[model samples]
Target: MVKRQAYQPILITDASRSQHDQLRSRQLRYIVMMSIRAACLVVGAILVGVKPPLLWLWLSLCGVGMVLIPWLAVLLANDGPPKEKYRLANRLHRSQRDETPPRSLPAEERPHPVIDAEQ
Candidate 1:
């Protein structure tokens, strides 16, 4: 089984607030669907009885519920700020470093005498 990894922050400068809200809403919808599916399975089991055949079905539903709950907690539960996104972006920036020298300033612009970097 592949172990799940924690989410890393990878902030995209272009991401808009509306996009974030839309993603949050979709996550909430998944949480609701999983909840309803679980309820249906439990009520169905109680109404019809957990026989040998139904036992396997019940177990399967329980397994699905187990998986869904954690995912819902991670994706939909608002955790105040998006720290993960920022960290991820930093990691990406670090991996893309190049050692080229910076472009020289234009000849028309003289260096300001008051600004001393040699200090």
Candidate 2:
């Protein structure tokens, strides 16, 4: 008698986001960050003209925002989704399995037929 394996249901939660969706999200994030940087520049210019009480502090904050936003935005835009735990585990398991020495059959165990060279 043969034993049957249990059935497993496919779960939608296991699926990763599509490339197009991921790209769109990243693009939106980058745009928002750049917009913030532009706002910082405008605020800095306004601060320069108005000369507020804490003029130096406000200008320094805006300058920092303008300088940092682009660097962070670029880094985030280029970043890809992290590998799933099961995916990493499977890769490691596969590599380890491949590295194991292959078994070889003894001469007698290997199939061979006599070759007649004098025929």
Using lDDT as the measure, which candidate wins? 2
Error of 1 at 47 (Å): 7.8
Scored by CA lDDT, what does every candidate get? Answer: 0.55, 0.75
Which ranges in model 2 have alpha carbons more than 4 Å from their true place? 83-86, 90-119
On a 0 to 100 scale, what is the lDDT of residue 33 in model 2? 100
64 Cα displacement, candidate 2 (Å): 0.4
Candidate 1's residue-wise lDDT over 1-119, tens digit each?
Answer: 99874333343443435557867876777677667667756765674664656676766776676667666666555444445567567545754663333336332232221211222
Clashing residue pairs for model 2: none
TM-score of each: 0.35, 0.69
Model 2 compared with the native: what TM-score?
A: 0.69
> Which 10 consecutive positions of candidate 2 have the poorest summed lDDT?
110-119
